[model samples]
Structures are given as C-alpha cells and as structure tokens.
Target: MKLHQLEALVASADAGSIRGAARSLGLSQAAVTRALRELEANERLPLLIRAPEGITFTEHGKVLLTHARIVLNQLEHAHNDLERLRGRVEGSLTVGVTPWITLTFLAEAVRLFRERMPDIRLELVEGLMAVAQPLLRDGSMDFAVGQLQPGASELEFASEAVLTYESSVMVREGHRKVRARSIRELLDEDWVLNFAPDGKRDLVDYLFTRHGAQIDERRIVRAQSVATLQTMVEQADMCTWSPTILSHVPPFGGRLRSLALREAFEPRQLGIVTRRNSTLSRAAVAFIDCLLQVIRRHARSAKKEDLALFKTLELLI
Candidate 1:
C-alpha cells in the first residue's frame, strides 16, 4: 500500500471518524475512506468497525493501526530528513514528557525552541514514563524528559540528575493542616496522593514505605495531573506532595501553603532521556544542544533554585 494509505489509516484510527481524519489530513472524506479501503485490501483485514457515533478498531485492525502509526511516523521523519539534507533544519521532533514536567519546565523549553526553529515540527506527547519508553525505541520520539523508574533500559542518558528539591504538602492557605511543621504531625490529616498504576506514589511514599509507615491508600484522592490534585487539595482537607521547584511559581506558591514533608522527603531525580544505542539526526543533535543550553542557563541563574543535582557530562561527551 502507498504511504498515503498508511497515513490515512493512522489518521482514521487517531480521529475515530473518516470525517475527522479528513479534516486532520486536509483531504476529502471520500479520499480518506478510499485510502482506508486500499489499506484494508492490502492487509486483508477489516481495520475499522463503523458505528453511528464513531469507528472502533477491530482486533486485527488494532494491530495494523499500531504498525501503521509507527510506519507513518518514520516515513514522515524520513521525508523531513531529506529536506534537512538540503540545509533546511526542518523535521518533526516528538518528545515525551511526564505530567509534572509538562506543567512546569516544558513551557519554558518549548518557548525558547520555537523561537529558534519555527519550521521544526514539534509534537509533545505527555504520559507516564512507563508508556513513553517504547515510542522512544521505535523512533517515534527524538528525545524525552521524565523521571526514570527502576529497570527502564530503553532510555539512554542524554543529560540528567538526581534533581534534589524539598517536598511540600500542598494545601489551601490558612488551612488547619498547614499549621503542621512535619509530616508526623500531619499524619492524621487527609492526603491526596498521585496514584501509580503499580508501585509507590511519590518521594513521600518511598520514605514512608522504607520507614515502615502504612500508606493510607484509602485517603488518596487519585489524580492524573498535578493541577487536578492541587484543585482537590484546594477545595477539600486533602494535601498532596508539591515539588519545591513548582512552588516557585507565584500562583501555586501563593494559593497553596506548603508544609515540609520531613528531612527524608528529599528530591527525586529528573532525567533527560533518549533511546539507548540509537543515533540522533544532525537536526536532533542541534535541538538537544538548544535544550541543554536552556537547562544550563536556568541552572546558573537559578542556583538557589538548583537544590542538589548530578550533572553528568553532555551526551556527546
């Protein structure tokens, strides 16, 4: 099947409707439908189940959709690389970011990168670190910045550190629990924990688990993003762990009163990661340099902000 057919297939899977897929690719609905047919014929599998509301992928269709997306992303990047070979530093670069970084530092990096390379197509995919690693391996992403959990081998080190920062219990200002100086005093208070699919929640969980404190899982106000968790904490008697770096922001710092988590509630490491044993394009290398420069400048200017981090040498080093 043609690349356009695969592109159309992937788009259809993404948008869940022929009309929506057409809009995304700037193609007519009939054209997208025809392309999907062509892909289905080539694969000899029904790729979609049409419904009134939207389409759903059949079992085989889901497999094909996954393969189709990987192929289309690579083909698009290949086309971009061809353009770059002619001295145009232009191509799509998709990066995976964790929710925590997505809320804070990513905005600054995106702002600076766009100014320098406006033509470089950018895609930011945000999810848990576990979900992002395979995309990095399959060439769907050029780089990623997130926390590294145990046994994540696909992600090679670009530049990262044990980025140390104090943990704070985020609560509304003037809340009674805010008066607690230590986590011990606040133990009986309600907690809004960021629920992990498996494993511990945060640095607080790590410390408490190590010290044999039972994490009251029932007290958790499970949330996927910091904003949502913060919102719940603001409205209710629950509190969440807010990294000190985030507390620097005015609205977060002002509206949310932070009580110390205890001495053991040290900082978690935030690493800049890429696929292991993978080669980066020239443009990708340049973009990584730009990202590092941004980080270095931020580190230098905000030395007080830099709590305790292990700065490994550059990836090129």
Candidate 2:
C-alpha cells in the first residue's frame, strides 16, 4: 500500500475517527476516507467499521495498525538521522527517568544538554519502570534512566549499570520513632511507599518478611510522587524508604532523618535502559554522555560521610 494510505490508517486509529484524522493531518475528511478505502481494497479485507460514535478496527485492521505504527516510527527516526548526518542535533528527544534520578542529576544533565544543543526539543517523563517500559517498547521514548531490577537481562532492552546506591528508612526529624533500633519496633507507625507493580512494593514487603514481621497493608499509603511522600512524612506520623541522595536534598534533607534499622539490604543498581537493536539519534547519545559526566563529577566531590556510607553498603561507583 501507499505511504499515504498507511498514514491515513495510523492517524485515524490515533484520532478515533476519519474526521479527526483529517483535522490532525490537515487534509479533508473525504481524502482520509478515500485513502483508507484504497488500503482496504488493496488488501481485499475490511479494515475499519465506521459508526456514528467513531471508528472501530476489525481484527485484521488491528494487526495492520500495529505494523503501521512501527513503520511510521522508523520513518521519523530516519528523518532525525538525516538531520544528524547534516551535523545538526535539532530534533526532539524524549526521556523517561525515575524520581530519585530526576531529583539528583537529571536536571543538571538537561541544563547542560540544552546549553550544547539549544535547538533540540527535550521531553522528560518521571515515573517508575512499569510506566516507562511500555513507552520504550512502543518507540514513544528514546531512552530511560532508573534502577535496574532483578532479571532485567531477560528483557528485550539493553541496560548499562552506572552506579549502585543504598536506600534507608526515613522519618520526620526528631520523631519519636527515629531512635527505634529494629524494623519491628517501627512497625506501629504508618508507612508511605512508592507504588510500583513489583519494584518498591516488593522491597518493602521483603524488608518486613526478612525481619520476621508481617506487613501491615492497612498502615501503608502507596504513592508515586516524591512530593506527596515528603508531605506525608512531614505532616503525618509516617515513614518511607528512599535513596540516600533524596535524604540529602532539600525539604527532605533537613526535615527528615533515616532510622537506624538493624538489618541492612543490598544496594540497588542505577542505570540507563534503551530498546535493544534500535538506532539512537545523536541528541539521545549526547544526553546519555551528559548524564554519565554529571554522575562521575558528583561522585568525585561527594562528602566523606557520603562516600563512607556508599562503601559501607558495598555500592559500586
């Protein structure tokens, strides 16, 4: 089928109707319908069913739409590559990052990247791996920076471990439970936790199980935003497990303190994740370099206590 026909099909699927697709593509509704009909005629199968409400794809249409998206994504990538070959990094770059990384080094990396490639558009999405993975697989994101979980190597993505960092149980400063010596002793207090499919939730549960304590789901408030977690810890008698870097940053740095739990878990590996076998744009490569540089510089000038803590946790830099 013609490229225009594929474009019509994909755009209509995205917009939910031929008229909406025409508006998006700056074409007439009749033209969009004609292109879609031509595609169906060529395939000798009904692609979509038009209705007053909108349009619904047939089973065969659903399969074709998936391939159409991949083709369109590849075409866009080719255009970006051509621009890069002309010695200009002037295309859009979408990146996904975990909250801790966003707070620690992502802002600085973005600033430096903008300075070097001012014409390039940058989109930053902050969330957990469960949210970012789908975007990466669907060609909606260029790359991601976050924690690498167990069994990551089995996935269809390439991951490069940059550093390993420790996590701690944090509580409001001067809270009565700050001096609690054991995990079981702090179980009475409510907990604010990051809500991930199998990431932070699993870690919290593992901590309780390892300490021979049953997890009290009723006392847990699951959240994904760092700001919400901080507000809850500051205003309520609640605690959370956070990256050591977060405990060293503002609002949290002075307002929160880590509990001295008797049991210590292994440090988590932080890194970059990208779709395997995909060609990256020059802007994406440059941004990844910028991130690594910032992390290395921060590691070098880190405070002695911070270095000692990383060493104590057996973290790799």
Candidate 3:
C-alpha cells in the first residue's frame, strides 16, 4: 500500500474517526475515506469497523497499525539521518527527564545547547520512568535522563551512569525532633510520599519493614510536584526522603535540614537511557554532552561542606 494509505490508517486509528483524521492530516473527509478504502482493498481485508460512536480497528487492523507506526517512525528517522549527513544539527530533539535532573543540570544544558545550535528545537518531557519508557520504545522520545534501577539492565535499552547519590530523610529546619538516628525512630512521623506509583513506595515499605516499623497509612500524604512537597514539609511536621543533591539546592538548602540517620540506604543511580538499536541525532548527542559537562562542573565547584556531605553519603563520582 502507499505511504499515505498507511498514514491514513494510523491517523484514523489515533483520531478514532475518519473525519478527525482528515482534519489532522489537512485532507478532506472524502479524501481520507478514499484512502482508507484503497488501503483495505489493497490488503483485501476490512481494517476498520465504523460505528456511531467512532471507529474500531479489527484484529488484523490492530496488528497492521502497530507495524504502521514503526514504519512511519523509521521514515521520519531516515529524514533526520539525511539531514545529519548534510552536517545540519537543525532538527527536533525530545528528551525525557526526571524532576531531579530538570532542577539540576537540564536548564543549563538547554541554554548551552541553544547557544551552540540555535536552529535546533528541544522538547523536554518530564515524568517518571514508567511514563517515559513506553515513549522511548516507541521512538517518541530520543533519550531520557532519570534514575536507573538495577532491573533496567534487563530492558531493551542502553543506559550510561551519570551520577550516583544517596537518598536523605529531610524535615523543615529546627524541628522538635533534632534527628532520627535510625529509620525506626521516625516511624511515628507524618510523611510526604512521592505520588508516582513505582519502586519508591516499595523502597519505603521495605525500609519500614526491615526496621520493624509500622507505616501509618493515614499519616502519609502523596505528592508528585517538588514545589508541593517542599510546601508540605515547610508548613507541616512531615518528613520525606529525597535525593541528596536536592538538599544542597535552594529552598531545601536553608529551609530544610537532612536528618542524621545511622542506618544507610542504597545509593541511587542517575543516567541517560536511550533506545537500543536506534540512531541518535547529532543534536541529541550534543545536548547530552552539554549536560555531562554541566554536571562535571557542578561536582567540581561544590563547596567543602557539600563535599563533606557527599562523602558522608558515600557517593562515588
């Protein structure tokens, strides 16, 4: 079938109606209908079942739609590759980043990248790995910077470690309880937890279980935004465990204090994750290089007090 035919099918599937696809593709309703009919005729199968509500794909159409998306993505990549071959770093780069990275080096990297290649457009997708992984696999995201779990090695992606940091239990400055000393000591404290439904919750559960502490579900407040979490901690008697890097930054730097805990938690790995067997654009590579440079510089310029804190956490460069 023609590429336009495949495009029509994919667009229709995404839009859930032929008229919607027509509007999106800048084609008339009759043109979209004709294209769909031609595609089905060529394949000798009914691809879509029309209904009053919308359109639904047949079993065969569902399988074809999957491959159609991949094929369309490959075609787009081919165009990008050709542009790169011409030594043009003027294209779009989409990157997924966790909040920690965004708050740290991402802004600086974006600024540097813009100065180097002003023609290239950069799009940043902020979310956890669970939301970003699918986008990466489907060729929607070029690369991602986030926490890489141990199980990530089993996935069909390649990752390179950028930084390692320990998680710290934090509270507002000058709390009544000076320090926890141990996880068990903080069992009765109100906690502000990450809203992301992932290993973070599991990690907290594991720590509480290992320390023989019962987690009071009623005392737990789930929040995803860093600003919201900071507000909760500053205004209430709530505690949270966050990446140590945040403790050195503003808002948390003076307003919040990391509790001295005798028990150690495992250090988390931050890294760049990219799809395996996919070619990265020159722009994406340049952006990552800029990010690494910023990170290295930040590490080098860290104050003695921050260095001491990093050493205490056993963070490896």
Candidate 4:
C-alpha cells in the first residue's frame, strides 16, 4: 500500500515485534500498530501473528514482506542516487570481493574512488560466489568481483570478464612431487583446500573426476585461510591448486612453486558480477569504472608473456 505501511511491515519482520519496529523506525508503538493495521486492511490479509514470544508472518505476509523489503531498499538506493547526482557525498556502498581480487586491483580502485568521493562509506566483504549471490540478489551488495566459471547461472546475474589467468598446481619449493606432471602422480599426497564453499564443484574434485580417478578423501585437509594453506604447503608434504597469477605475488610466490601440471579450467578468469537489469547507484558506476581502469592499466604495464592468454579479457584502446 503506502510507503510507511511497507516500512512498518519490513521493520516489524526484521525486529520481530511492533514495539521493536517502532523503536527502530523512531515512531511510537501506537504509530507502528496503526500502520500495520492499515496495511493489513489495505491488502485484506493478515500479515503478522502476535504471540507471547514474537511476531510471525503468514503465508501471504511472507511473500508480501519479500517484495516490501525490495521496495524499501530500492527507495533508499534511489535517494542515494539522487544525492550523488546533486553532488552530495552521502550514503554507503557495499561490495563483495574474493581474496585475490581484494589483494590485486581493488586496492588501486578504492584509492581512486576515495579520492573522488572521500565521504562515502565503503564495506568490502570477502568470500566466494556462493556467499555473494544472495547479498547481490537482495540489494545488500551493489556488485562483486570474483572468478567467473563458464555455464554459471545467467538468469539473475550478468558478468563482464576483466582478467584471465592460467591455472597452477602449487607445492613447496623442495616437495617430492614438484616434478609430478600428471593428475595421477599427485593423488596420493596430502592436499589442502583454501576456500569457503563455492556451491559449484571444486577444482580438486573436478580434476580427479575428469581423469577418471579420485583423490582419497582422507588425505584431503581443509585450510580456511591463505596463510594456513601456504604454511601447510611450505612446511609439509602437501599441495594445492590455485590460479597461476597467485604464484607471482611476492610473499606467496616465495612460499610455493607452481607444478608443471598440464591442467587448467577453461575460462580461468575473473569478472565483475551484478544483478541483471538493475540500475546501479552513481557511486557503484564510478567504482566499477575504476575497476576497469585498473585492469586496463595492468594489461598495459604487465609483462607481455604473462598476459598473453588474457587478450580477450583485457580490451585496451
């Protein structure tokens, strides 16, 4: 119905009670109750159930609440967009980024953005695509930068390929399997996984299965952080898979070496992801421009051989 009515529904759903919603909305409890009652009357449906414990949504209420949240969120984005158009530096932006992207072009892009809009608040979340999609869908995050596998879902998202990298099998400097060239050669050694659940099939699992073989699950070790994964690979007889680019970064390069395994995922590249058909805020457009700028600059300054295969991703003028 009305915007205030939608606000009351969303706030009540989030806070779980009219009193709590009133406090959050900075309105009186009577005001919140009235808004909720009016919203129910307008829709001719009961949206909430009040109990001793808390508030619960009915079936129709649940469906309507989802739309209500989006409306309010889009309204806020609209306000922020207009503020930017008026040359006002107000409102915050949230972006999801994966590890390597954060460590690479993000630093430079953020520098450029901060110089242009110093007062805008920024939130950078780190995780894989699985963790980012829900936030992206709900408008919590404006966009994300991460690896984009082929055949990824396209109905709700769009991708612009930014950088492509070769893949590598990494091991410690003097590890016994450093010379191993085939997938079968390294299946027996201990392995470490260094990413959160990405919902899709993982590199190691896919690698083995592609060759009609499998890695013993018992030999697989889970390491959540880069430091842990590197430490294990460096000090112990273990190995891991990574994008070939990581092997060139300073500290990581010194800790491990890429095995000469002839394996790589097709489209071993990174891209910018956003919700399809959504209008991005002005700040988001500016930040993404910087992202593309950084990628272009990198393609120019980087060694010729290193980016030789990335011709498709790096569209320089």
Please tell me which predicted candidate would have the highest lDDT against the true structure: 2
Off by over 4 Å in 1: 1-5, 15-47, 50-54, 96-108, 123-142, 149-173, 179-184, 195-208, 254-258, 261-263, 274-284, 302-317
- Write model 2 residue lDDT over 95-167, tens digit each, in one string: 9998877766788898889897898888999987777777777678888887645566337678778777788
Q: What do the candidate models score in CA lDDT, each in turn?
A: 0.67, 0.80, 0.78, 0.77
Error of 4 at 121 (Å): 1.1
Question: Could you give candidate 1's per-residue lDDT for residues 1-317 as a string of tens digits?
Answer: 78888788778877889999999999999999999888889889888899999899899887777667666656666777788788777777888877655654567778878877788878888865666766765557876777666543634534355244445566777788777765666666677765445645554556465656666666665677666777787787677775654555544656777675553565566666765545555556666666667666656653644432213112221
For model 4 the TM-score comes to: 0.82
lDDT of 3 at 46: 91
Model 3 is weakest, by summed lDDT over 10 consecutive residues, at: 308-317
- Per-residue CA lDDT of model 4 for 193-312, tens digit only, reads 754455325655576778766878777787766677778888876888776666666567566787776664553657788888877788888888887887777777767643642443
Candidate 3 TM-score over all chains jointly: 0.82
Q: Mind giving the per-residue lDDT tens digits that candidate 3 earns over 83-155?
A: 8689865578889998777766678899998998788777899876766777777667888987644465337
User: RMSD in Å for candidate 1, one decimal?
Assistant: 5.1
Local distance difference test, candidate 3: 0.78
Q: Which regions of candidate 4 fall more than 4 Å away from where they truly are?
A: 33-66, 148-152, 194-205, 221-228, 231-237, 302-317
**Pairs of residues clashing in candidate 4:** none
Kindly indicate the candidate among 1 and 4 with the higher lDDT. Answer: 4
Q: What is the TM-score of each candidate against the true structure?
A: 0.70, 0.84, 0.82, 0.82
> Which of the numbered candidates is closest to the native, going by highest TM-score?
2
